[model samples]
Target: MSQFTTPPPLIEDDIVQLSYPAEHILQIKMNRPKAFNAMNNALNAALEDVLNWFESEPTLWVAVLGSTNAKAWCAGMDLKQVNLGAKTMWTRNGFGGMTQRFTRKPLIGAIRGYVLGGGSEMVMNLDISVAGEGATFGFPEVKRGVVILAGGLERLVKLVGHQRACELALTGRNISPQEAKSLGMINYVVPDDQVDAKALEIAKTIASNSPDSVMATLYGIRITDEAGSARSAHRLFVDSAPIKQVHSGENTIIGVRAFAEKKQPKWVASKL
Candidate 1:
């Protein structure tokens, strides 16, 4: 691995970076260190483009979210840009386009330093997250005269409950990685040096699983949440069976094997 500032193979400029391989794991990186990698229009557009590709492209099983600069994963939308009258409907697109409903593939957020406002919201949408030990998380939108319309408040509420969400959103305060983990927001808190490695480890784990089954499991979880009526449940049920078969029974077997082996599981998946 290169320095955090070094561009990845697929990166062209300062906006974003991408790389994909046979493992079916795509890494999407925000590359604007100057503005704390703020959510600018160009970054949003690039993210949207990559997200669309990730969803439509075949054999893609998982995505890992990251930032180039170690100092800040993202400081949220460029408040200066917003203050300067820049157009910003893309904020609705979510951090690096994770909020796009059509792009329902699983994502793992690999966070390092500061993750605030839109950055915070972006992680909220990911299926799992790994934050660096020095990473800090917050909504902080209130301090900037913006509403948490990009799903930060909603997701924060879901993760930590209403009162805690209000406390963070209302104060725009920062929370350490340990606190975030305690609140159940991040899956793991690794050292700064290990952030990307841990994230890729998880992403590889996800990619190793049967792609069809992983997609279905993700779909099933989403459908369960959206199942507001019997009709919706029925539809989900109808759509879910094919997916279950694609899910490798190896996932279960690995769990049992790990327990018996008295060691951490090294999970693997193959194409269905």
Candidate 2:
């Protein structure tokens, strides 16, 4: 049996709280409610640290990102901090230390209240999202005299049709959770109190599967999603190293034997 080790204690003064609610689930919460959980130098660094830790932990299977504030998930960047010459907003993994990172592990976002500007951009990078009934999504960068440069624009265009994405980007208007769901921006919209529960439910379902298979599936999906064409996607899927790893992993044999014996499988941690 594989021994599970506890993660290290989160650093003091961490604006983002990293906690393990379950053996395989890592929950990261933005903790600056007074500023609406705005992304500042401290918050950005804290988030980067959490993500780096998650990437290194082989036993962890999924991550859930959310905010502690009730009024807003995140109101976006802290202009005051930025104007004061705080440049710690961007990390090697992009905004919020998540947008650019390529990891086989999945991330799910639980959002409520306002998700504007960079908040909305961060959602674009998540594998899945669960929004509260009061959730509002928008790209208001244009209203602030800036462009949506955090990869939201391209993702928005692909998520909804080009026409709708253009309207949202140009007008800087917010959309209700229903509208966002209709546009395929989020996977689920539950009552405000149930947002976290709904996200956890989904995360648990993913975590119960074989880690190697889950990683291979997500890896293939991401590669194909980025390939931009049927021919390219097909080629990428065929050559995916993660898929090959899954086929050669012990978890595959364990899964088959468990299924045949009518028993639950004890999945091994995926090294891919």
Candidate 3:
């Protein structure tokens, strides 16, 4: 059987915490219930560290990101911390300071309460999202005389549609978890008590798969999303040496055979 290992710690204090089990799943908890886990410099830096750890750790295959309390996932950027004059395009950390970090591994968001402004963008970056029944989501930057410069508007448009996204961005409205699910913003909406459990369950399920295939699948999906032309997308994947190696490796062979035989694929985890 393939054994699992834990990733390096990413927390600096009560602001952030990271814990990993022997199932290739990294769980990152935001610890700032006092402020509704507001997005500030300290929290941003902590998130960046966690993302960096995920990118560098080869053993990990999946991540679950959530908040410490059930009242708020994140209340968005701290207005006190926002300096309008310091605006820059696609800053080092795209949205919350962890935006620039890249990883082939997937990020799953477990949202319980309000995921607003900056918080909304953070959740949108994840490949999958699971929210609690009372979860609330919004991008009220427009109400503050500021705009959604963190890629929230654009991403929201892609997530739903231009019309629906425009309504929220223009009106600065908050949508309930059920509405978010209907708009395709979340995958599952469970009871508040089941949020973390469901998120971990999904993460472990993904981690149990062949890591090589998982990475390739993620790469393909992201590349396809960015590709403007079909030819370009095809060339990008075809020229990827890592993808080629994994496709021809024993893991793929076993994964394929397992599927055909209706059995679990016996595989080993390899370093990136």
TM-score of each: 0.80, 0.94, 0.88
Tens-place lDDT digits, model 2, residues 184-244: 9888999999998999999999999998888888877788778889788878887778778
Worst 10 residues of 3 by lDDT: 1-10
Which candidate leads in TM-score? Answer: 2
Ranking by lDDT: 2, 3, 1
Which segments of model 3 are wrong by more than 4 Å? 1-10, 83-91, 97-102, 256-263
lDDT of 1 by residue, 122-156 (tens): 88777889999999888877777778887656667
Residue-wise C-alpha lDDT for candidate 3, range 1-272, written one tens digit per residue: 12335446446676887777546788888888988888777777777767766766766778889988889989987765566543333336666554443447888998999899878877766788999998999989889898887766766887899899999889999998899889988899999999999999999888888888888878877787668877898899878866887977888888889999999887667444
Q: Model 3 clash pairs?
A: none
Candidate 1 — what's its lDDT? 0.75
lDDT (CA) for every model shown?
0.75, 0.84, 0.79
Q: Model 1 Cα displacement at 24 (Å)?
A: 1.9
lDDT of candidate 2 at residue 271, scale 0 to 100: 80
Clash list (residue pairs), candidate 2: none
Highest lDDT against the true fold, candidate: 2
